[model samples]
Target: MRKHVRKLKDELVKRGLDAFLAIQNTRYLAGTTAAKAVIVPTDGPPVLICSRLEFDQAKREGWIRDVRAFSRWRAPLRPGERVSFCEPLQLIADCLRELGTRAVGYDRGGKKFVRKLRAAHAASYRELPELMLELRKIKSKEEVTLLQRAAKIAMNGMRCAAESVTVGRTELEVAAEAEREMRIAGSEGTPFPTIVASGRNSWLPHASATRKHLRRGELVVIDFGATWGGYASDMTRTFALSPTKKQLTLIGLVKRAQKAAIGRVRNGAKASNVDKAARIIISRVGYAKFSPHGTGHGVGMEVHEPPGLAPDSKDILRERMVITVEPGIYVPRVGGARWEDMVLVTKKGCKSLTA
Candidate 1:
């Protein structure tokens, strides 16, 4: 927690701002209207202004420094009062003004308060969503631990998915099995909808699980992830319900490509280089056109983060950074094959944390 605050402070200094205003409403977390208001000031502890009703809950979470109540009718106004509806934002802005903050940074999508602040005070406001993105790009030790836990839950789900691969089993059945395993393994929920595509359906990247039954000698693509403690772990593994010569061959190619991509990951390597390393092998196997998506992406609080491994991405790999190395090939009428693994960038090479 202190580390996150320090990082936010450093960002404020870098951006020449005195503080940051983080405004979040419903859809931010569990769809609650008592939006969270956080004021991260440079050179001191951060303050979290939450609805009076949520103050106790936030304090219990211990994710922030100071937790203050924003009320409408008591001294500050009570709950169910119209005045309380307007107190949080005004208090936040007033606090900034008192700190002599002339410029404040924020993430995007708070136009209402931005307009109000601009109208009331002469303070210049800047939006730096990217700053928050960059700060979150590198995971801390606690974050890495949580991600490891998430990965374990995902691996459990993967094991369940692998076991569910069999002739006549519907795609939805396989997906449901994976989801049940994730929940039993302590995952809050699946990070995204589980993808259980068999045979032709495997060719679709984000194919929704359906009732189509699996067939012998067909490939089943299981793309899934689980969320634990707000961190996400993504992985994909293709299975052959009944082995066929051609299916095994394509899976081998994709596995090789994924291995090559993971082998190329290291500190200071260009994201594009890792992607190219995988694409080259897949292309050499006469499947260039079949490979659609980028190799992988950074995994963290969000399923997908910065430093995407793509041909056009300029992100440089850094030590301690965790990312996915997934390479896939889809043959239109045949089937698709992909192998994904979460890896941690290291000084010499990379380690597959989810392996």
Candidate 2:
């Protein structure tokens, strides 16, 4: 069994759960996102339940040995597996009944799943609060390697952006160029839509790329992320066309703020402290109003996960936790500048994965 599964099983025992159902976070436990649901019994081997179409793929990629399928297209059955055609919900309930589990735990994503399972099974279903988050927050050595590869791909995309962005080029054109480069560099896919905002559009933090032509002396914010092997990396870089003094200053301040936030990412540091470290730097220069978003967020299977670097966040930093330290300044009618990078939290400090 994978270490992730062992950790979950240990937690299941502590919570007095006979079995734990996973609809989401299947990728975290078993390196495959193909499984629709996974059941981890406290005393027996875990089982992966996927659609018949995905059965072969999940069996090939999953770490666990027991993989079952539902919603028929009739794949070859394993030894002693007689039932070949069962509805997904009935199969799930049957599996729990076979395990003789009375109390089952499930993630937040299993609300509807549990409701349906309750109608079919007599097992008690309860939510496991932050169970997957706690299990996936820490990066194993292999997970870090995958994240590093993702970061390298994202960096290649940014380099493409630098070469492609020029006066008169449409924002969409630049974004397309960067995305193509990332694909060529071996990214599984983009974690989120690429953000290539120029001029007034850059003033919006989550601005979508448009057909607007890039103008001289306008700031361009390119936020992009690349995924590899179910891991993700996020990064942002600001470019100036003709280079105004204000644009340069904004870039410099945001960069410094990002650095400050990253410096506070060591183990045991509070997530709010990291956000404050960046906020204070930008606020000192009277750009506090211009900075609306949080300092950053955790980057993993999903681009935005846990351990958020925001003022109201209660998460604490821990070693091997991968996160992004992003700081930005957006002035209305002027433009916006953001600096973001993925970092790995360590005991002494954090290492930049997307420098």
Candidate 3:
């Protein structure tokens, strides 16, 4: 993440901003969700500000060295004794003012906070959401390593869930078993709720687990991901309670769609073209209407990010960008099937992490 911070600083300099201020809750700063803040200057080490509640832990786990305890609110005014409450982000404003920061960039901040910054220090601010997103779109080597581990855990969960599918087991039970395996296997948590949909339920693309029991000759779709070290891996697999011609055909078609799309994922590939690759197969199978969503999305700290793989997307794939190649066809009574895999873009081609 040192390189990420350094690149951000470069962008700040190019924008004529003195620094970049990122709050913890935004989840764009260092892939952290802790209740803290980070201020990165163009020419110096970044500073981390932690509230009293998060101070000790931040000091232990934070990357920045200049960690400071966030200042507390002043004692309540003594019956109108001519004292004023602390301004919004007073500590942050004071730090910037002392550093002579006349301009700053941020991913997101409230109006009140921006107003206080301008009023207290005469500092101007510009939005850095695009810059942040661009930085996050390409996965660092370390981030990809973490995501590779996450993908392994998710693959194991899928195996467990597939084995648990039987005539008597409810969808909820299968999902629970998969979730348990992920947790037991060292996953910090799940990116999203485990999904185990069977029979008619499979027709609903994002269906959650229900008490409905599985039965023979039905389709079952399990979609889930594991979170490790704040990175996520997403995948989906379809199973059959009992083999049938139609269900098997549906699964084959989805596989073909995924293969066609994943083959197009490489550095310099147009994201929309990848979507078209998948859509061509589904449309050829006469199930295009059943596919409602995009083919895939960039994945990392968040389950979904930029560089969308869809018909309307203008994003282009870049080397080291990890994404999900998910293709599905959902039909009502005929049942539905979807297969997804986590892949990493490469200069020559892409590697399937779930393979």
Candidate 4:
């Protein structure tokens, strides 16, 4: 947590900002809203302004030192009248004004608030959504540990889903079994809604589980993730109720493609090149047009983060980065095959945590 704060301060300095801020109501790091605010100045300890309802929890969990009741903030106590936030800017601007800040960088998606802040306070504000993603791209040691544990738990769920998939079983039933296994193994929740795409539905990359029952000679694509300690792990594997030569062939192609992609992961490697390694093989087999999505994405506090592995991406892999390698093939009316695994980028290459 201290490291994260220090990094934020460094970014503030790099961006020529006196301070930075983010607002969120819930304890989720991904949360961003007005009900709760975090103020981090380049020169001092951070402060968190939260509702009285969650003040105690924030004080305990938030790494900030100063915890103030958001509701108690008044627009410069008036002598004969009441003041409100309508006239004053957001708490971030308020903090900067109090610190005599001249420059500030804030999270994105607050055009109205940003305009009001510039009008009300003499400070420069820059939107920093991409900045935030860049800061979170490299995983810390603690984060990697949690991701490894989450991968272990998620693999158990994948196995459960694989075992539960048989002829006559509903897609929902298979998904339920996988989720139950992950929960039993100590997962707080699934990062995404569990997917149990069966038969024709397999062609849909992100299809939701339906009531359709599995049948012999059809494919079942189980894509899911388990969350532990706010870290997430994503994995996917296609199954066959009854094996066929063509089905096996497609699965092998996807597996080999993923292997080639994972082999390309390591420090100082371009993510686009890694994606190309897999795309070349898939495209050579006449299934390039069928695979419409990126090869994979960085996994961390969020299921999909920065450092995307795609043909058009400029992200470069670095040590301690956790990413997914998923290669797939989809054929209309003939079902599809997708093989996915989580890996930790290392100096030499990567370790498959979800293998």
Candidate 5:
């Protein structure tokens, strides 16, 4: 936690800001997702703000010692003010006012938030663009451990999904089975909604599970993730009860494409090149247009994050970054197959964590 604060302070120093305000889900910094806001000043300890409802929980779970709770009912007015402010933004503005902050950096907010903040306080605000992304992309040793555990848990779910898949079963049932297995395997919860797209539904990469039953000789794309200690890992596998020649070919190509993409995941590797490695493989077989999404994405606290592997991406792969290599080919009215695996970027190459 101190290391994260120091990094934020360094960023603040570099940007010439008095403080950085974190209003979004900053579990990566505060060690608790319940924190409503974290005021990271250039000096001294950072302050964590929580709602009166979650104050005790945040105080117990958060690493920041200076935890405060605010409520309109509990606020005391000093002047001829008729009533206390109800919005939590007002409370945060009051904190900045109390700190005498001249300039503040914020992680996320829209025009309304900015206007309200400027109206409430005297400080100038600047959005710290992608600062959190820069910090969250690199996984520490402990973070790697958590992600590895998550990968194992996700693999358990994947194995369950593969085994439970059969004709006459509903996609929702298969999803439930996989989710149950992951929960039993010590996953806190799923990182995202468990996907069990069978038959034609598999044509859509991000299709949701439905009551549609699995049919023989049809492809079922199961994409899911597991969360462990706030870290996440994602994986996808296509299954078929009775495979056809086309299905086998599609699976083989997607698996090879995923392997090629993973092979490109190393320190100093271009994210676009990694995407191209998979794209070119699928393109050779005239399935390029069938694959629309990016090859892969970073997986960490959230299911999808920075360092996207796409043709237009400008991200560079760095060591210790955990990302997914998902290469898929979806054919309209036919079927689709995706093979995804979580990989840990290394100096020389990358190691598959979901294998």
Candidate 6:
């Protein structure tokens, strides 16, 4: 927590701001639901404003320095009475004003606070959401460990999903089996809704599990992920319930395309180049129109992060960055084939973290 505060303070200094305010709810971070606010000055320990219910926990966790409790309005005030309403925005503005702060930096959401500050005090504020995002893009050592664990859980879930595919099985039943495997493998839950598209339903991107039964000689796409330790891992692997010659050909083409994309992902390469490599392979096989989404996206604390692998994205690949390389070709009413893997960008090349 102190390290994060220092990073925020450094960002404020770079942006020429006096302080930064971070308002978050405990529901966002599991184990607590108290609303909390932190004030990070350029060169000092962070001050925490939290409810009475969270003060003790925050202190024991060593998350901040000052933990002040908010009070409610009453007819007769008690000895330790404080402000009635602890609206994060108003409290932040009041703190800044008291500290004679003229300029501040914060995440880009507090519109009411900004309005009140502009009207009451002639203060200037800068949005520093990008600064925080950039800081979070590069994973720390501990973060990488957690992500790797998530990938392993996801792989286990994928294997269960594959085994669940059979003739006369409903999409929902397969999804339930996958979810059960994920939980047994130590995943808190699925990162997103499990996609158990079988037969014709496999053609639709982001298809929800339905009552449709798996048919013989039909393709099934099981796109799923698992979340562990607040980190997420995403992977999509298509299956052949009892595939025909045509379905096998499409799956083979998609696998080749995904391999081509993964091969292009290395340190110092532009993300767009990876997308192009995959697109080239699919286009050569006459499946260019079927590929709609980007090649992949960064995955960690958030499922979708910066450095998207797409033909138009301008993000450059960097070492130690974890990302997904998924390539697909979806044919309407027929089926789609997609293969995905979690990769860690290395100095020389990329390593498949989940493999």
- TM-score-better candidate, 2 vs 5: 2
Q: Weakest 10 consecutive residues, lDDT, candidate 6?
A: 24-33
Model 6 stretches astray by more than 4 angstroms: 23-36, 49-62, 69-84, 98-100, 117-122
Best candidate per TM-score, number? 2
Model 6: how large is the Cα RMSD against the reference? 3.2
Number of the candidate with higher TM-score, 1 or 5: 5
Tens-place lDDT digits, model 3, residues 105-167: 888878887887788778788867677888889888888999999999999999899889999
Q: How displaced is residue 156 in candidate 1, in Å?
A: 1.2
In candidate 6, list every pair of residues with a backbone clash: none
Candidate 5's residue-wise lDDT over 153-272, tens digit each? 999888888888989999999999999998998999988888999888999988989999999979999999889999988999998769889888999999999888888889999999
Candidate order by decreasing TM-score: 2, 5, 3, 4, 1, 6
Every model's TM-score: 0.91, 0.95, 0.92, 0.91, 0.95, 0.88
Model 4 over residues 301-344: C-alpha lDDT tens digits? 88999889999999999998899999888988888889999999
Worst 10 residues of 4 by lDDT: 25-34
The top-ranked prediction according to lDDT is 2
* Per-model lDDT: 0.81, 0.89, 0.84, 0.81, 0.87, 0.77
- Arranged by lDDT, best first: 2, 5, 3, 1, 4, 6
Q: How far is 318's C-alpha from truth in model 4 (Å)?
A: 0.9
What is the clash count of model 6? 0
Give the root-mean-square deviation of each candidate in angstroms: 3.4, 2.0, 4.2, 4.1, 3.4, 3.2
Can you give the lDDT of residue 181 in candidate 6?
A: 88
lDDT of candidate 1 vs native?
0.81
Of 3 and 6, the candidate ranking higher by lDDT: 3
lDDT tens readout by residue for model 2, 1-355? 2888889999999989899988777888777877777898999888888877777788778887887878655666666443448787788888998999999998855567668888888878888769888878888898899999999999999999999889999999999999999999888888998999999999999998999999998999999989999889899999999978888999999999988888788999999999999999999999999999999888889999897889999999999999999899999878899999999999999999987
Task: Give me the runs in candidate 5 sitting further than 4 Å from their true place.
Answer: 75-86
Candidate 2 global CA lDDT score = 0.89
- Encode model 6's per-residue lDDT on 1-355: one tens digit a residue: 3455666677788778987765531222222234366667786666666665565666566545455555543345446534436444556566666667778776655687678766655678776676666766667777688889999888888788788888998999999998898898888877788898888888888897998999987889888888877788888889987678888888998889888988888889999999999999989978889999999999876788877999998988888789999888888766888888999988888988779
**Backbone clash total, candidate 3:** 0
